[model samples]
Target: MAVAGVLVLARSVRMTTKFTSALDIPVEFVTKNVKLRGKLHHITEKGLEVEHIPISIPLITSIQRKWQSKGLLLVKLAGVEWAPSGMAWLQQELKPKQMIWFQLLGREELALECLVLVNKGRFLSVCLNEEILRQGLGRTVPIKGLPHDSHLHWKLHRRLLRAELKALKKHKGIWQEESYYERLRDRISSNRVVQVNSP
Candidate 1:
């Protein structure tokens, strides 16, 4: 099509469309502009893969510090300070076979960078990554090639930084009063456990 003395390609036209969720909030009226809803199926080196979205979906975002592949995601969610390596815990918390929602922060190659939230009953949703960092389960790191809107992106960056600070202060996640070598050891050890446990 031609408009204002310029020709628009069909490919460009197709890319402009946005996704709206029927399972969650409406498109225009919602505070979060871009959203995706699906089931949590698996995890990748960098993020989570979601299903039932009718498209290729991977949800991940930039962290303040990246996790060195522990091979297994070690989560200490219970009252204790540490927990074993098991996918069952995550699956239970995320609730398998149910539709979950992701608020897209931005886009990266092959997936949408999103805030994965779990619903705490009616109208309340929790960002899993943020909560993880806040509770000292993980750390955050920034990645390159984020969105060009500095204002919006900076806001997200600040939020991640704040979460990291909280983790550091409480010595949560990988920062729990361990030496560098020991932290590395823990990461590797957890992975070994996962490998032995995987069927």
Candidate 2:
């Protein structure tokens, strides 16, 4: 889950194009997708619950300059309604004072018409439409041509982390760099946790 969260970062889309179905009907889509460090809050028969995902220390510091103190959360999602019950469910289940980042992963399926991705489980990746992404954020991500983690150095580091996380989970391996990670991890508790809930 953690690895998926990390891998899913960066390579994301920004809202620009108008969604259309095979019939050329206008459709909605979630603007942006993100997966940050958070904890599971609850679980229902149909959905999983989670909260308080931490961001990379560097990311927050770097993006904080322009984005508001409580960064954008409410975004336009095409073909998907903003479910108040869903948000309220989150508020009730998630731990009080828990802080984490929620990444908007793209639609569940590929087509001109889109459904905002919203998973009810240990982790919830909100499906937001392009309007949401464009409204809250100034950047735009084309649907294609994202820079993949294929460079030699990036691959090597990815491999190393993959191996380490595997070993750590398997047998509780020596956390050689616990102190290093501690220093490197962001202290979201100290900073404001932004929940962008606007369209």
Candidate 3:
């Protein structure tokens, strides 16, 4: 289905005129629909879950400009609500001390939205997204609700796609699990003995 809508980003940073549907509105819509500025509340391999309220405003809590880990950098957020018990599985995998900042990109599906993690004044847009995908944290799905006219946006999109390809080629993260499944299938087939009839 084709639907056209305009979503305004925070501080009037950018405007988007494309959206898929109401169920899966893009980051553009999220910014316009919800509050633009908010604390970076939760982080996981799946996607960052941010609770934006009318009063919540984005606050920068750290000045440490260093990389903490591969494909990840931490930035503290003050006065942010914690993720609920339903997200315990995801929380367990996260480092509570390392609360980073992210920008909503768009929606991938019904419950999941795409985000870009920023670190050291640079956007780890694809790395963070793909790292989660490669590690079997989440599925790599197509996203809509964005303007294709922006060169920068299109560039980021291409980078994300390339990261996924790299993950698949190197058998990193989720690809490793895929390989295991393949091996299991081979073993199962090998154990099956075919009946032979004498000619």
Candidate 4:
């Protein structure tokens, strides 16, 4: 095939990253723009743990600061205060029902409580059960661990770790950003496994 022919035939493919909803928001729309309405439940080293509880004027004032819900999903996404562990500790962190936009979809709504796994300061990987990934996104997959977590999960089998990073970066920037969402978008777009020109 001629070079021009190949160029004309080529199509940019973008791999949409879906969070396995260790909580409830759908992963398909993770990076897409969406809206969410709910009470902010938790913010830990993990991810946002929000509740479907309808907002009330009085309740809003009561839960100004992030508070733990005395329920099964006790801890949502842990905040920098409790867990200033790695790079995520640097995260300004979102507050309950504060209504902040996210790297994922714009949806402020959160599902059940899930652990937000910060991966190599590149991508936000949530540690979810295999079922959520399968059911939420509707697919059969391999290695449920986040890209960065893969190293720990697989015991840092060097070659394997390199392999995962190589593949994961091809998808998007999950960690390490200037904290500017646009730069984050640029890095994810240019450095992803599957690339596409999105609208």
Candidate 5:
């Protein structure tokens, strides 16, 4: 019985070490679809910069403090591409140091494609990806790192399309009509055109 107990303890230690080692590599975490919690650092043209808050594991973390993970992760919203107003909208919606949950879906190079959720109320959470489409601030795009015909890929695609449809119906943001300048320019150009007589 003593030998069995020692074996079990040894296995647990090995597993814990493996998990901690993976934390040190951000790409490993991204490829594994590891959910992370972090504070909003800033917005970038490519995507959001998030300061990752490493998960603390009791005594193990304290001992591995020198090797513990610490850095910003570039996160892009999965299944959506920004429109002209998308960046500005995101800037206004998310504030500095605001706590958010990053549900990683995939990774492309150094950027993690994720579904970013923020607290709406005491018990409510809002998905920023869908909201961006719903407001017409962004358009649906093929989700990277997912198979073209995969079930999960289709599920996310349908949801994003629905959000974009809502914006279209309401004529919001990009869906709205052209500006006055655009209309006036077209009118002036058309009036300047001359008709030629045929021989």
Candidate 6:
């Protein structure tokens, strides 16, 4: 009984432990697919900058400068390459200081590849990766940590592909036809005719 109590206490401590930076996170946590909560700070060309929210443990947190600012985590959405317009869309969709959850998919240098989720309502949470594809604002890419032939990889790939298909079928965003002026410009640039034949 004493051993079980100690084990439970250790697990709780592990769960509540706060990381100072991306490097402070344990490899096992990432591999086990741990989810962390943070506030949306801003979007950059490289990725989303999120301010990690440390778990508050009443008395213990009070001793640890409870009001001190937490460090930012640089996270990239796994399985999607954002388009230029997609960045704009993200800026508009996510408000500053909004609560969000990011599941660690993999780590690359100082940045983390994550599946970013935002609550749309009380019960619905939306995945930004698949949504970007569904909007035709991005293309699906391989998830970094998941093995290519693994079941998890295939499942995620299928979801992303389906989202992309929806956009293709609807002719949305990048899937839409080019304007006449743009098409004409491309044709003129490509056609190098020295002289035109007389009609």
Candidate No. with top TM-score: 6
Across 1-199, the per-residue lDDT of candidate 4 in tens digits comes to: 6987655433111111122232444455343323223345555544455433322345343553244233212223211112233224223433335432222312233323222333334454433222122122111222222343444334423423343344244432232232356677878877664545443
Candidate 1 structure quality by residue, lDDT tens digits, 1-199? 2674243433332222222222222233123545555666564344555652423212211220143121211111111122232233354566544566666553433445555667897989876656666766555655233454557656766776687678777776566744466789999999999999999
88-196, model 3: which lDDT tens digit per residue? 5346645544333344443334433334343433543333554444443444444443455656456656766675667677776556678889999988776664323
Per-candidate Cα RMSD to the true structure, in Å, reads 15.9, 23.5, 12.8, 22.6, 5.1, 3.7
Using lDDT, give the best candidate's number.
6
Pairs in steric clash, model 6 = none
How high is the CA lDDT of each candidate model?
A: 0.49, 0.33, 0.41, 0.33, 0.77, 0.83
Q: Which stretches of candidate 5 lie over 4 Å from their true place?
A: 1-32, 178-199
lDDT of 5 at 76: 89
The better candidate by lDDT, 3 or 5, is: 5
User: Residue-wise lDDT of candidate 5 within 18-126, one digit each (tens)?
Assistant: 2222234355555666677778888988988887665556765566565645567788899989885999999899888998988877777777788889998999998
State the local distance difference test value for candidate 4.
0.33
The residue ranges of model 6 lying beyond 4 angstroms of the native Cα positions read: 64-69, 177-199
Across residues 13-54, which tens digit of lDDT does each residue of candidate 2 receive?
Answer: 112111122122122222332333334444333223333233
Name every residue pair that clashes in candidate 3: 27-106, 134-173, 134-174
Q: Name the runs in model 2 displaced over 4 angstroms.
A: 1-34, 37-72, 75-88, 105-199
TM-score of each: 0.52, 0.22, 0.44, 0.22, 0.75, 0.83
How much is the lDDT of residue 135 in candidate 2? 23
Query: What number of backbone clashes does candidate 3 have, counting pairs of residues 3 or more apart or in separate chains?
Result: 3
| Model 6: lowest-lDDT 10 consecutive positions | 190-199
